[model samples]
Structure formats: structure tokens, C-alpha cells
Target: MPPKQNPDAPAAPDASDALDAPPTTKTPPEVIEFWQETKQTPEELAFYAPEYLCLTILAVILFFPLGLVAAYFSYKTMQDNKQSSWEAAYVNSGRTGWLNVFAILIGLGIIYYALLFS
Candidate 1:
């Protein structure tokens, strides 16, 4: 007796069938651009984002309170840069850098006192 086969099921294509069939052309996926597609203005080109994130992180590690303050200013500086407020960014960047430096210095001073005075 012959084996039972499903008549509704599609048959596998042979090499001859492939040669007879038209080639399928798949459309490429659309490439989307991030932000804007247009060119930036002169001022936008001159964007100076001086957000010292590494220093802020280091400062945070050195001294919690003061480093938190420095991190705040660094965040403000980044916000200012995004808002295109160069003057405000400049002020905030300076404040952030100084605060980080001061925080590091304070940590070093504490260490010095602990080691030498002990």
C-alpha cells in the first residue's frame, strides 16, 4: 500500500521550479536620522559643552557633600549648553571645576591629618 500524504500541503520546490520562478527583490529597511536632518547654524556649530562628568564622579567619591554640589553645577553646565546659553554654561563650568578641585583638596587634607597627626 502507498503512504498517506496531505494533499492541501504545499510541495517543496525543485531546482527546475526555482529556475522557472521570478527572483524576489526585497526592499531595504528605512534608515532614520537622529535629531535633525538639516545642517546646524553657526552658533549651534560653536556649541562648547564642557561637562566634566568624570571629574564630578571623582569628586563625588572624594567628598560626598561638596562633590554633590559640584555635580549639581556640572549638570547645570550641561543644561546651559543644551539651551545654547554660553555665558551661563561658562559660569557653571568654572564653578563645577573649582568645586571638584576643592572637594578633592578637602579629602586630601583629611587624609593628611589622619596620617601625620595620628
Candidate 2:
């Protein structure tokens, strides 16, 4: 049975009207990202190139061969620095220091052997 409607009242909304309307479109959620960036100044980038020429030369006086090798490394370190090759300079510097130490040690060893044998 149909319900009775009052003549003075506004027409009721149709259920089909809601369904017939276009649906709201689904959109992907917005993506947000964060990152940290580092900046360096020229002064901050400045690095020292090590050279032990005097030490290597003295080592040469102690043990000629090792000292010469050490001096060569020292020269390479300086050359690398002049060429703006920091890593190579650093390696050469370390080599020179170690060679100098070995040279001095060998010199002392020679003296010790001479004294012990004499």
C-alpha cells in the first residue's frame, strides 16, 4: 500500500536521484620527502700536504738506499700537492715517513753489528 502525502508538503527526495549522481573521483595521496644537504666552503676544503724532506735526507745519510727511497717519496708528495692530487700526496707522505724510520733503524743496526763484531 502507498503512503498518503500531504498536498501542501514538498515532494520527497528520490533515492534513485542520489545513485544517479556522478561519484566523487578517488585521488592518490600526496607524497612528501625530506633530505639533508651539506655544503663546503673553500677554506673548509683546504688541506695540508706533508713533506719530510729534511728527515728523509737525514735518513739518507744513515742508510743511503732507504733514505733515497724516502726522499723520492717526499718529492712525489710535493709533486702531487702541486698537481692538486690530495690523496696521492697523502699516500706519498706516509711512505716517506715510514721509509725514513726504516732507514734510520737500518743505520743503527749496521753500527750495532760493527760494534758487536769488533
Alpha-carbon lDDT, every model: 0.78, 0.76
- For model 1, what is the alpha-carbon lDDT of residue 56? 90
lDDT of 2 by residue, 3-91 (tens): 98899999888866644343334422221111011122233236647789788888999999999999999999877766667899999
Candidate 2 residue 32 C-alpha distance from true site, Å: 52
* CA error at residue 68 for candidate 1, angstroms: 0.6
TM-score of each: 0.63, 0.59
Candidate 1 — which residues are off by over 4 angstroms?
A: 1-45
**C-alpha positional error of residue 75 in candidate 2 after TM-score superposition, expressed in Å:** 0.3
Residue-level lDDT of model 1, residues 21-78, one tens digit each, is 4434442323112123322334464776688899899899988899999999999998
lDDT of 1 at 85: 83
